[model samples]
Target: MLVGVLSDIHANRIALDAVLDDMPDVDAMVCAGDVVGYNPWPAECVDEMRSHDVPTVMGNHDRAVVTETGFGGNGMADAGVRYALDVLDDDRIEWLAGLPESRYCFDGRVRIVHGHPDDPNRYTYPSLFSARLLGEEDVLIMGHTHVQAHERFDEGIVLNPGSVGQPRDGEPTAAYALVDLEAMTVSERRVEYDIESVIEEIEAVGLPEATGARLRKGR
Candidate 1:
């Protein structure tokens, strides 16, 4: 089966749309999470994900937006997350609250999570920690940290499609991944969008200035 993996869509509809436009057709989708926080349209992003039928895990930022837990960092994420916490409707919050931290044993080989296996709170990357934990599974995908890359680990393969909304790697394009489980191959991909338009929306929505700036640079 081919699975499209996406994550960290911090409510930037433009970026999300760009990634979706570029995404190859696949049998299923697994999102690493953070459907909200640090962007212009949290609700719209959530709706888009729902419409796409993407199966997602709860990200730390997504949790913070719902519970007001203040777990995310105090960087560009602070303002938009705080606003989402204040404005999100109860039903949407409940939807986020019901999301799991991880999904395992799906095909008895592929696994998915918002962060590392042992601790979702810890910021683990494919280049750093994923290589060790991927095991012999067909695929292990995750998002957080907003960086995009794929690593062939000791046991299997680890893929980070990157951040669909808040990329911090100095690139404006949205990031994602395509995985073919039958072939055991993964590819990182990016799609360009109207960065300035999203920035204007952020400003219009009164999100943090830093958040707006990061969208252009992908940082």
Candidate 2:
């Protein structure tokens, strides 16, 4: 089966829409998490996920908004949580609240999580991936580092589709992945979006200016 993998969609509606429009047909889709955070359209982003019925795990930013535990002292992250809380209604917040830290989809052939399998908040970078990370599942999918990378082992695959919003991978543009489960291969993809419009919206929403600035640099 083919699957479109997504993660770290930090409330940037434009970026998410661009990625969705750019993606090819797949049997299913899964999000590693953070549907809301650090952008202008948390509500719309959440609704997009719900309407699509994409199986998603809870991200650190998602969890912070739900649990009232702010993201330590990161101003951008804290602002995002506050903005999402203020903008998202009960049902949307409830949906975010109900998300799990890790979940299995496609009949357990794939496992999805926001961070490491052992810890959701940990940033598991490409350099850290290994076969030891796999646990019975043919594929282990994770986000949180916002860097697009994948590794194939004799046992299984470990992948992070990358961040749909607020990519920190140094090379701008929204990131995603196409996973061919039967073929045991992954194809990472990137798409351009209207970053200026999102920047305008961020300022209009009164979020931190640096939040919008970083998208231009993708760092």
Candidate 3:
């Protein structure tokens, strides 16, 4: 089966649309989390994910914004995060509040998570132990650092699709991944979109102006 993977979509409809436009047909989608936070279109992003029937896990920023917690102050240093915190209504926050921290196979083969497999709150990337220690997993996917990576482990492969919004890799484009389950291979992809649109929304909502700048730089 073919699966499309997306992560850290802080809330950029433009990026999401661009990725989807170029994405190949797939049976399902797996999101590495952070569906909201550090972006101006949290509600729209959530709605789009739901519409696509994507399976998702929750990230640190998602937890903070959903619960009105302050843990995201560091992860959400970007202007978009601050804007999402201020403008996301109660209903929107509730949606994020309901997201799960981890998802995987019932038999212990495949797994999906935000951040690291060990600790979703602190770890930014998956560890070798997570794959080898987890025991016989076919594939493991995660995201947090907004940098694309593919690591081969003793047990399985660990991949990060990077950030759909708020990418900090000195590039303004959004990043994602495509996984061919049958082929047992994954590749990272970067897509260019209108960062200015996300910024405009942030500014229009009276969010932090720096939020707009982050989108342009992916940081």
TM-score: which candidate is best?
2
Can you write out model 3's per-residue Cα lDDT over 112-173, one digit (the tens) per residue? 88877677865554333345534456888878788777876666778888888778777788
Please write out the lDDT profile of model 2 over residues 130-159, one tens digit for every residue.
Answer: 999999899999999999999999999999
Q: What ranges in model 3 sit over 4 Å off?
A: 71-91, 105-108, 125-134
* Residue clash pairs of candidate 1: 167-218, 168-219
User: Candidates' lDDT values, in order?
Assistant: 0.80, 0.94, 0.75
Candidate 1 residue-wise lDDT, 41-144, digit = tens: 88888888778777889998898876776645585667877777776788778888888898864566778888887778777754585556765566777788
Q: Estimate each model's TM-score.
A: 0.92, 0.98, 0.87
Model 1 RMSD in angstroms: 1.9
* 54: Cα error in model 2, Å: 0.4
User: How well does model 2 score by local distance difference test?
Assistant: 0.94
Please state every model's RMSD to the true fold in angstroms.
Answer: 1.9, 0.7, 2.7
Clashes of 1: 2
